[model samples]
Target: MKLYKTFTSIIAFLLLTSCSVFEKNRSEQNELAYMKNIEDVAIEVSKKQYVNLLQPGDRLIILVSAQDQDVVKVFNQNYSATEQFRESSVPRGNIISNSQPINGPTYIIDGDGFIDFPVLGKIEAAGMSLDHLKQYITSSLKRYIKEPYVQARITNYRITVLGEVRNPGQFTIADGTATVLNAIGMAGDLTIYGKRDDILIVRNVNGLISKERIDLTDAGFIDSPYYFLKQGDIIYVTPNKTQERLAKRDPNSALYISIASIVVTIIALIVRK
Candidate 1:
C-alpha cells in the first residue's frame, strides 16, 4: 500500500510539473506572437508610394557613353577628369595600376540649385527627376556630341532608421527606390516589444520638416503616399508598455523559469522513487 501511494504521488507531481513548464512556454510564445503582429502592422502601414524630388547639395553622377571613339573623346574632353577616369584608362589596354579609379563627372549643385555642365552651361536640377535631368542634358549634348547617350543618377539617396531596431544607422539606396518597409528590413526588423501601430516617419521637403504617424495593422497602407521613402527620411519604432514592463520586471525571469522547471522535475523524481 505504501509503495502504491508513493507511485501515485510521484505520477501526480510529475504531471503538475510538466503542465507548469508547458504553460510557461505557451505564454512566452503567445507574447512573442503578439509582438510580431504589432511589427507586421507597422510594416503594412509603410507600403505607400513616394516620389523623391531633387534638392540643393545633392550629388549626381552623369555618364555619357557613345560608340564613336572621336565623339566619346570630345565628350570626355568637355568635362574635367573625375577620379574614375584616372583609374580606368590604361596604356595599350593593359592595366598599369590597380588602384582606386576616378568615376563620372561629379555634379555639385551650386547655391542656385544649378550645375555647370561643360557644354550645357548652368542648368537647374533641383526638383527634377532623374529622367528629367537626363532629357535636359541629352538635348544640350545633341548640339555638340552626335548620338550621345546620357545617364544620370542621384549619388546620395539615403534614409535613417532609429529606435527599437536591431541596428540603427543611415543606409544608402543605389537604385533610388526605397520604401519604409525596406528600411525596416535593413535595420533587422523591430524588436519583440516594438509598437507597430505608432511608428513615426519624419520627412524633410523643400527645407520644411513634417512628421507623420503610421499604423501598420491595416492592409490599406499600400495606397498611402508615404509608402516610398525619400532621401533623408527617418523611420522610428516605439516600444509598447508591455515590453517595457517585461524588461523592467524580473530582469531574471528567464533564469527563474529555467531553475524552477529543473527543481520541479527533480522533486517529482524523488517523490516517485
Candidate 2:
C-alpha cells in the first residue's frame, strides 16, 4: 500500500508538470485587452490616412494612351495584346508570365529623384503621388499627342512578414492600399504559438528607419500610427514563451524529467524497504 501511494504521488506530480505542455499557449493575452471595459462596444478608427508616394528604388508602371494610334504605337507596351506599340503598358512587380511574356521598357528613377522620360528629359518623380504623376505626365504629353491621358501605378509596392507566421515572405500590394491585417492574412495568419499581442512593424520613413510594436488583441492598437502599412514595411510576429522554449535547444527539460524520475525511484525504494 505504501509503494502504491508513492507511485501515485509520482504520477500525480508528473501529470501536474506535463499539463503545461498541452496547455493552449497561443493568443495568451487576447482576453486581457487594455481598452476592455464593461461598457465597451465600438471604437472609432483614428489612423492618419495617406496615399503612398514615389520613392527611390521604387518601380512604376507608366502608360500613356490617346486617340491617336501612332502615339500609342510609340509609347504603348506589349503587356496587353495588339502589337502596334513600342513598349509595354504596365509592369508587373514580380509577376513573370512566360506564356504571354510580361516585358517592358522602364524609366528607372535616378539617385537625384529623376527619370529620363521620353521628350521630358529628367522629370522629378520621386516624391510625386500616383495621381499627381499621372497629371504631370498628361500635361507634358499634351505637346506631343492630343487628348493625352496617363495611367501610372507603383509596381514594386511590397511588404514582408516574418517570424511565427504560417508563411513568411515578401508580398506585393497590387493597389497600394494594404493594411496590417492584410499583411498578416497574406502570411497565412500567425501560427498557433504566435504571440498576437506583440507584433513588430519595421518601416522606412523618408530616409530614417523605424520599428513599431503593435498589439492585435488591443482595440486601441487599431487606430495606431502603425496600423496602415507603407511601402517596404516588414512585419514580425513574436512567439510566445511556450514557443520560445520549444524553439530553444536547451537540455534542461530532459534534465528536469530525469530528476523527477530519479526522485520517484528513490521514493519507491524507500517505500519498498
* Per-residue accuracy of model 1 over 169-208 as CA lDDT, tens digit each: 8876644666667777777788766767677999998689
TM-score of each: 0.68, 0.67
- Show model 1 residue runs off by greater than 4 Å: 1-50, 73-102, 223-225, 267-273
lDDT of 2 by residue, 3-84 (tens): 6686878867876766655454424534333335313313344334567667777666666778886775566543443211
Model 2 ranges with Cα > 4 A deviation: 1-20, 24-48, 76-104, 205-207, 249-273
Q: Candidate 1, TM-score vs. the true structure?
A: 0.68
lDDT of each: 0.67, 0.68
Over all chains combined, what TM-score does candidate 2 have? 0.67
* Model 2 weakest 10-residue run by lDDT: 82-91
